[model samples]
Structure formats: C-alpha cells, structure tokens
Target: MHKHSYIFITFLSIIGLLVSSCQQQTAQSDEPQQTATPKDSTEQLVLLLSPDQMKTIDLDTTSLKQTTIRKNMLLMGKVSVSPTHLTSLSSVVGGHIKTLHIIPGQRFSKGQVLATIADMQVIQLQQDYLTAKADWTSVKENFERQQTLNAQQATSDKNLQLARAEFQKLNATVHALEQKLRLLHIDPTTLQADNIRQTIQIYAPFSGTVNKVFVNTGQYVTPTDIICELIDPRGFILQLNTFEKNLPGLQNGQKIAAYTNDNPKAKSTATIINRVSSLDDDGAGIIYATLDQPNPTWVTGTYVNADVAVNNYIVNSLPQRSVVSFENKQYVFVKTGESSFQLHAVDIGESSDGRVEIRNPAQLADMPIVQKGAYDLLMAMKNKPEE
Candidate 1:
C-alpha cells in the first residue's frame, strides 16, 4: 500500500506540470495579433491641372486690362525684271554683217557702232545720189543762164521758164536723196568727206551692255533679225508677283523690303510702281511690283522673297500657344467661373513669331485665357467630368 501511494504521488506531480504547460500555450494562442493597415490608394494618383485649368482656377479678373490690337497682312512674292527696263536690238535694214565691233557683255555708249553692214543696196543709193548731185549742179548753171537770157530777151520766155522749173525739180530730188541716205544710217559728213565710199555703221540706241549677239561675219541681216540684246545693269529694277487678293492693300509707292539667300547681308527697298490687273490661268491674283535700287547680286530670272508692309489696324492679340486646332476649328480654353475651364471658339487673324491676332476681342474681355499648357488642358477636358 505504501509503494502504490508513492507511485501515485509522482504521477499526480507529472500531470500537474503538463496542465501548467497547456495553460501557458492557450494564453499564447488567444493573444491579439497586430496587423499593419495598407497605405491609402488615393494618395498615389496626382491630379495635374493644365494651363487652361490653372487659368480657370487662378485667374484674377480685377488685374486684367484691355489689350491694344494691330492688324497686318502678310504676302509672298518673287523678284523679277521690270518690262519697261528690258530692251531688244535689231537691224534697221537688210545687209551683210561686215564686222562685229562689240561682243556680248561688252559695254557701249549711246550711238556707239555695234557692227558695220556691207549693203549693195546702200552702195547703189549712194551712187545714185552722187549722180543726181552732179546733174543738179549742171542744171542750176543752165537755169541761171536761161534766166539771164530771158531778162535780156535773148531767148523765148517759155524756154527760160522750162529751164528754171527743171533746175528746181532736180534740186528737190537731190535734197530728198540726202534725207534718204541719212535714214539709211550713213553719216552725211563722213560720206561727204570720203566721197560716199564708207560702209554703213549700226549704232546702239542706249548706253548698255550687249547681252546677246545673233549675227557673225558674212551673215545676212534684216530689220526683223535680232542683232543683240542690250541691258543697262547700272539701273536695275526688281519685279515681284504678288497674290491678287492682296491687291487692295497694295498701292503705288508702297515700300517693300527684299533679300536673297545668297546675299542676306545686302537688303534692297522697292516701291510698288504698278500692279497687274489680270489674273493667272489658275484664277489666282497677281501683281507686279518694282524696286529701283541697284543690286548687282540680283540676276534676271532669279527668284527672291519680298516683304510688303500692309496698313496696320487695331486688333486683340494673344500668345500663339493659347490657340488650339480641333476638327478644323480653332479654340482656346477660358476660365468659366472658379477652378473650372471651358473651351471657347475663337477666330484667328494674322500670326507672326509667337503671337496671333484675335478677330473678336469682346468675347474674351471677362474670361481668363489659358496661355500655357493649353493643349494639355484640352486633352484633359476631353475625358468624362468627375462625378
């Protein structure tokens, strides 16, 4: 009985230890677990307000002032030669080209001999004139004798009158022949000195350079045949063709500035001397403008740009970026009330550099316009409005 009691006490002690360990494990299992909450998802998205939105949200109505507007017209044109300044040279009569005294690009003074003509017709005319002159001299002597005889009653009045009439007729014929020789370009003084043996000489009508030469030695030439083209490079005029729609703004004496890519440093000013009344075959308008300034760098047939200043008028203007094109129409984001933007359609005018003229200024007087980030604002506005 004592051995059994001892073994039972030891088993009771082991059971008590097992029960305390289980109580401690249950307390650990029932303890509250600490879990971290996820961060707010709303903080990850950043709302970016575009320039249009900012203008609508932050525009100050009290500080806005009325803007002065200026209207201008822009036109594109090309440089050309004035038709009035261009000239063509041709022979006055038919003949064989004896010599070419001047070559292309050579300068000549007015009345300078360009070439000589060995014309058989001119030679025959000269011969006839000489013979007529000799006959006229003899006839004048006879007429004087006949008049003297008539006064003395040594010859009949009829014979004396006949001699005098013949003499006068011969004299008139000789004078006519002299004029004809002069028209033929024969120098009367030279002809008289050399007994009319010199070949006819062709002279330039104006002082200019020979731009073209058509005849060589021993070539046949006529009045219709072109001998050369003369141009006075010293007095050059620039011709420009402009659009017809811009014709109303263009007037005589309007100033224009011109330049070329090759000669950017050199600038020339021209005046609108004339405008073409006709339109091109395509129905586009055209105007002819001229510049009197001499430009050696400007060659005929060379194309150049011209800037013509049209009259200026008042207009409302804004930064070019403020305007956006949508569906072939232009619009600007304007402040409607507070922190909100609305798209407003606007008519655009002349634009240059970074500014554009607005046609209707009254519509924008009380509204805030988006000057920066306008395009971004437009893209954002295209989305559904926040509920």
Candidate 2:
C-alpha cells in the first residue's frame, strides 16, 4: 500500500509539470509569430518554413526581368485616299476627239498624252499668229524710218506719232497671238506657217491612274467637258476605326500591319500619322496611317484590317504564373528570410506573351520572388490558420 501511494504521488508531480509547459506555450502564442515586419494586417500573411518544408512545397525563386511588353489591337476599317489625291481632268478647248490613246484604269505619267483633238481653230490661231508677226515687222520698220526722218526734220511730228502708235498696237497683237499658240501646246518658237497643223494633243497634268473616261474616238468635247477622272497612284492611306477605349493605346509614329480580307497574307506596312479628335455617332475615332508602299492595284474604299501593337515599353516583369490574385488584388511572394516568404501587393501594367509587367518593381527589386511555386505559397498561406 505504501508503494502504491508513492507511485500515485509521482504521477501527480508529472501531471503538474505538463500543465506548466502548456502555460508557457500559450504565452508564446500570444506574441508575434515568425520574423516579419510590424504590419500584422498584411505582414502576418507569411509562410515560416524550414528547408525540408520548402523542398516539400517545391519552391523556385527568381528576380524581376527587364523586358518589353505591348498590347496587340486588331482594328477594322477601309483603305482610302485624301481628297487632294483625286482630280477631274477636262479638255482645255472645244474640239472633236480625233484619237483616244488611253482607257479606263490605265496608269499615266505627267506629260503623257491621253487624247488628241482635231480642231480647225488650232490652225486658224497659228495662221493668225504668223500674220500678226509679219505685220509687226512692217510696222516696226515704218516706226524706225519715221523716227529717223523726224530727227532730220524731214517728217512732221504728227506722222512720227502715228507711226509709233501703229508699231505699239501691232506689237501687242503679236504678243497675244503667241500666247494663244502656246496654250494649244504649240511652242511659238517652233511653230511656223509651214508646220501649222489642226491637231492638238491633250496631256496628263500629273502622274495618276485614270478612273473614268468621259470621251471616245469621234466624240465631240467642249471646254467644260471632263476628259477623265484620275487619282494619285501613291496616296493611299489607312482609315482605321477604333473605339474611345482604345485611344489611349494609339499614338503617332506607331506602326501597323494592314491587310485586306481577300488577301490577308499580303501585309502592307503603315505608320500612324494622326488620331482624329472627333468621334462618330457610336463614339468611334479614326486612326490615320500612311502606307509605306502603296499598292496601285488596290481600289479606293477597299475594306482592310490593321494590326497595331500599342503601348510598347520596357519594364520590370515576371512570368504570368509568378503573380497571383488574392482578395481582388494582385500579389507576389517575396522571400524575406531563409525559408520564409511574404505576400507583397504589386501594381501591374501591360501584359504580353505569357509575361506580366510589374509597375512597382522597386518594391521587389532587392527581394527574391517565388517564381514557380507562387500559387502553392498562396494556398499554404490561406490555409495556415486552419492547419
């Protein structure tokens, strides 16, 4: 019985010792856990682990990378030209279309003849110009002879004055006729009574492609008649329609790859030149870009697609999986201590090609980030209390 009593006393002492150890553990639990900052509201979200735990979690660490990111935009619109590129060519004089040297949709260079007119008026003008010149020569000789006689007192002042007046009038008439001959594409210096012809060729004023032909062979054309409608061959532009939401992404000098629905594989490079401030009824804006090489075969008003890479910039970034969303905010895991990681709120920018941009990279510049096991750390942190 004495032995049994001694054994019971020893069992009570052991139970008291266990109770004291439990009290000490409860006191420590009331204090801060892990070696972290003082912001318990956010800093307390930490994973305090050992090397074995890290290996079990399969964590991989990395640093921020300086790389470029851009958002791709697919724009819808059509290829068009400025009003300055379009022109209406008309016959300079009334005549019959003797011969037509051009057809619709044909490209022409400056000074290339489009048609010729058989106008008898051209021959009459040339003949009148030559006759006026001959009359001017006779009047000039008489004026000189009268001036010489007046200096010698052999002619009256009235006679000298009359000769001068006739000379001036005939010279003015000769000048007017010469200009008329030149207007008919006849160089007055190269024209003579022997070389006078009734045919005058109409030439292109600018290098362009004919859009419409208004006259044919044996057709009568007047001064008000349009010969053809022409368009500048190299003045094609892209008029891409974009919404207000996409305005911030577009800017001058950015490049675009434009293509048509019929031939999407054939891409034409273009550069943005203007962003229209005015909006359409649907609040859509215009993005004007000039093509590097204008395709002459492309008809005006052709519907086209523009692929623009916008807001391109170099920034600190990480793999897409390296960052995770929590509580409606973006965050990343940064290694604060050996086997310890803290959740950091990061400001994200543009994302591209499986990579995400970190706008506030300075916050994590000196810290190692959990690159591969970010989602794992997030799960562990969320369930830490439950465990």
Candidate 3:
C-alpha cells in the first residue's frame, strides 16, 4: 500500500509540472508583439549619390522663385475642316455607281470629273432634248413664212395666229429640255443625234482631298445617299470645347499650342477666331481656332490636345526640368540633406516659358529641388537599393 501511494504522488507531481509549463507558454504567446521601427523620412525616399557620381550626371539644384508666368488652360479638342470648306457629294438623280475615278486621300481640282452614273432615265433625257430641238426648228420656219404671207395679205389672220401659237409651244418645250440637260451636267449645244450619252458625269465642285467613298462600283444609290465626302486641308480648324466659366478669359486672336494625341510632342500653333456664345447640351462652350499654317497631315475628327493662353500671374515656379512624371503623377526630388533627396508629390498648374507653376507651393516652402537632372534621379532612386 505505501509503494502504491508513493507512485501516485510522483504521477501527480509530473502532471502539475506539465500544466504549469503549458500555461507559461500560452501567456507568453498572448502578450503583445513589438513592431520594427519605421524607416526615417529622408532614408525612405532619398537617393544618396557619391560626389563623383553627381558630377558625372551634371546634377543641378535650384530654390523656388516668385515670378510672373503666363497661365494656360489645357483643353481637349478635335481637328475638323472649317464649315465653309466641307462638302458632301451625291447624285441629284438616283442611279448605280458606274465608274469611280478617285479614292479616299486622292486630290482633285475643281471641275474635275469624279465619277459617272448610268441609267435608262439619263438616256431618255438626251433623246427628249434632241426631239424637241428638231420640232422647234421646223415649226419656227413655218411660222416665219406665215408672218411674211400675212404682211403681204396672202394668208388669213386666223391661220397666221395658229402658226404662231404652235411655234411658241415648241419653243417652250425646247427651253425646258435645255435646262434639264444643264442640271445633268450635259451641254444642250452638244446634244447631237449621234453624240447622246447614256451616262451622266459628276464633276467636283471645288478642289479638295477625298475624305471618304461610301459606294463601290455597280452599287445602287439614291439622291439621298451620301456617295462621298471632301475636305480642303488648307482649311483645317481646331475645335476646342470648354466650360462656360472659361469663356471670359478667351478672346479672338489669342495664341494656342495644339497637338494631336498620337504625337503630343509635335506641337503646332493656332489662333482663336471666335468663342461661340451658345452652350451645347452638356453646357460646354465651343471655341473655333484656325491653324497658323495649315497641315495636310491633319485629318478631320482627329482628337487633339491644346493649351490656351488665358492670362499672366505671379506664382512660385521652377524650371520645367525640375519636375518629373512617374506613374502618371508629377513629382519633384526635394533636397533633405547634403546628399539626400526625397521624392515629393506636387500639384502643378500652368506651364509657360520653360517654367512650371506650383499650385501648392506651400508644401515645398524654402526647400531646394533637383533642377536639371530630376529625371535621372527619379530613375536611380526607383531602381537602386540602399547600402
């Protein structure tokens, strides 16, 4: 019995020791863990370059300065042919497209034959013109003879009047046919018996490049069908849409920097002609601007970006090179120490004369910035790691 009691006491002591160890482990795990210290503000975004490295890259630094900058309003615009220079081509009479002499982008002069259309109606028109001409000639001769006879008292007045009436009716018919032939671009004088044409020719009314061709050969079209479009490249206009609040600063002859979205760097100059007073359905106002010099490369309806010179004002500004674009956001490298710079986010406003306006200048108050080699620094800070 004592041997059993001793064994029981030993087992109880072992259980108590195991439970105490487990409780200690659980208490340790439940306690709060300490977090690592965050990186210093300068070290987080700074690039520490050696003296030789800075010289090799030609780094430049400049402080902010208060200067007058011409403010520009950036706007989205579209390229279009001036309303006076646009034209739509279609046949006055419906028929199949018989022949096409030009394609889109081909240049043609005024009065040039563009295409030909064929139909039985066109042929019938020529036949009627010829028949009327022949009948009128015969009747005219008979009437002149009757007039002579009446003057000599050899014919009755009633017979002379009857001949005169018949002659006038034929004359009217001939005149009507002549006008119809003109509308068909056919010369009435050229309507000889053997020279009648079954097809009518359509001529270009003005000189321009073919903008579009809608029909193929042998395709049927009606007078309402838009067969083609033409636009003069010399009359390319920049149509800028802006809010009504921006109207006060716009004026005729104001300068504009315009460029296409496809080639934003190739900027072209334009002059505002007018700011329309009427607002569109979206409450957006339109301003028409003509290119300082027309470009044949500009196509109608191409999206464009433009900057309009609104006015001038004093602001804290810096050289344009001091700012860098990253991930679609503008940033500046601010000098935090002798060899350290932190990437700083900035809100930019108007840019002009190689300078950029800082909208929130207070954020960068009295701090030096990477002026000339900002882009190089941005690349280095983003790619290189700290030692």
For 318-360, candidate 1 gives per-residue lDDT tens digits of: 7888888866889777755545566667898776656777777
What is the per-residue lDDT of model 3 for residues 68-112, given as tens digits with 9 covering 90 to 100? Answer: 777778888799888678888999788988998989989899999
lDDT of each: 0.71, 0.86, 0.86
Instruction: Name the 10 consecutive residues with the lowest summed lDDT in model 1.
Output: 57-66
Where does candidate 3 stray beyond 4 Å? 1-69, 82-86, 104-107, 142-165, 241-245, 252-257, 261-269, 273-286, 312-358, 361-387
lDDT of 3: 0.86
TM-score to true structure, per model = 0.60, 0.62, 0.58
Steric clashes per prediction:
6, 0, 0
- Name the candidate, 2 or 3, with the larger lDDT value: 3
Candidate 2 Cα errors over 4 Å, as ranges: 1-55, 58-69, 146-165, 252-255, 261-267, 312-319, 323-372, 375-387
Error of 2 at 139 (Å): 2.6
- Sequence-dependent TM-score of model 1: 0.60
Clashing pairs in 3: none
